[model samples]
Target chain A: SQTIHQWPATLVQPVGSPLSLECTVEGTSNPNLYWYRQAAGRGLQLLFYSVGIGQISSEVPQNLSASRPQDRQFILSSKKLLLSDSGFYLCAWTGGYNSPLHFGNGTRLTVT
Target chain B: TQLLEQSPQFLSIQEGENLTVYCNSSSVFSSLQWYRQEPGEGPVLLVTVVTGGEVKKLKRLTFQFGDARKDSSLHITAAQPGDTGLYLCAGAFYNQGGKLIFGQGTELSVKP
Candidate 1:
């Protein structure tokens, strides 16, 4: 069975502070990874996605960036956080095209 | 950018009631999927409809892909409180390698 993990489950960051969120998947290799953010009661906004290590595509140009350091390890980072950056961030992985995505628990980031 | 539009952003119904959520798009997709997400958790794959006009059933939930492969719908029969969650529809464009464009999502609340 495949499983995804993300942490910290919740985060509180001061404005302009650096931020980092990590996601790891087990039981799969070379899977595509994605980063998404959701505002309260709103739809998900795709931030970035990676096909392989060191390859990332940004859907929205913002303060956040993503990196695939390993086959199953993905990281979302920001040099400085903005108030608008506060939201629930999700990490997802899929085996290939048209495949179902499996998601992690998600990180609730609060930028005050 | 390809966009998916979901209808009835929020739905609240009593247990044993029936309800339907829709996902519409102008562009054709190779595949479409439905997911359900609970509060504080990542979305879980409910079903995947690949072929146009395809229909899949899981327990009390039925999913249908449009004949044109541009839309889909999920129907719940005699919904239960455990069925309450956010419903999302995502589509994979042809040759897109499963990079999904997500809909705004429909929040469904089934009360006992």
Candidate 2:
């Protein structure tokens, strides 16, 4: 069984502060990872995705960035948080293209 | 940009009622998936349809992929309050390495 873990299930940060969210998967290797953000009453927005270590693709231009340090470890970071950055951030992994994705519990980030 | 549009952005119905949620797209996809998400939790994979015109059943839920692979639908029979949550549809193209483009989710509330 594959499982994903995300840290800081809930976060509260002041404006202009740095942000770091981590996601790790177990029972899978070299799986594709993705980062998504969902605002209240809005659809999810894909922020970034990584195919392999040191490979990251930004889906939309935003204040966030992503990195794949290890095969199953992905991180989402921001140098300075913005009020617009507040939302539910989700991490997902899939075995390959066309495959269903498994997601982590997600992190509720509130920027004040 | 590839985009997926979901209809009835919000739905509320009685527990014994039936409901159908639709996902539409102008571009064809290699595969499409349906997911259910609870508040404060990540979306869980419900089903994935790979072949065009494919239909899959998961207990009380039935999923169908359009013949052109440009759309899909999920039907729930005898919905329960436990089914209340956000439903999302995602599509994957052949060359995208399984990266998914998500739809504007449909929030369903099944009341007892």
lDDT of 1 by residue, A2-91 (tens): 899999999999999999999999998899999999999567898999999999999998999999989999999999999999999999
Clashing pairs in 2: A97-B97, A97-B98
Candidate 1 at B80: error in angstroms? 1.8
| Native-interface RMSD of candidate 1 | 1.1
Q: Score chain A of each prediction against the true chain A by TM-score and list the results.
A: 0.98, 0.97
**Cα lDDT, model 2, residue B91:** 91
Residue-wise lDDT of candidate 2 within A1-112, one digit each (tens)? 8889999899999999999999999998999999999887456788999999999999888899899989999999999999999999999999987778888989999999
In candidate 2 chain B, what residue range of length 10 has the lowest lDDT sum?
A: B90-99
lDDT (CA) per prediction: 0.92, 0.91
DockQ result, candidate 1: 0.81
- TM-scores for every predicted model: 0.97, 0.96
Q: After superposition, how far is residue B6 of candidate 2 from its true place, in Å?
A: 0.4
List where candidate 2 sits over 4 angstroms from the true fold.
none
Off by over 4 Å in 1: none
TM-score of candidate 1 relative to the true fold: 0.97
What does the lDDT read for residue B105 in candidate 2? 96
Predicted complexes: DockQ each = 0.81, 0.78
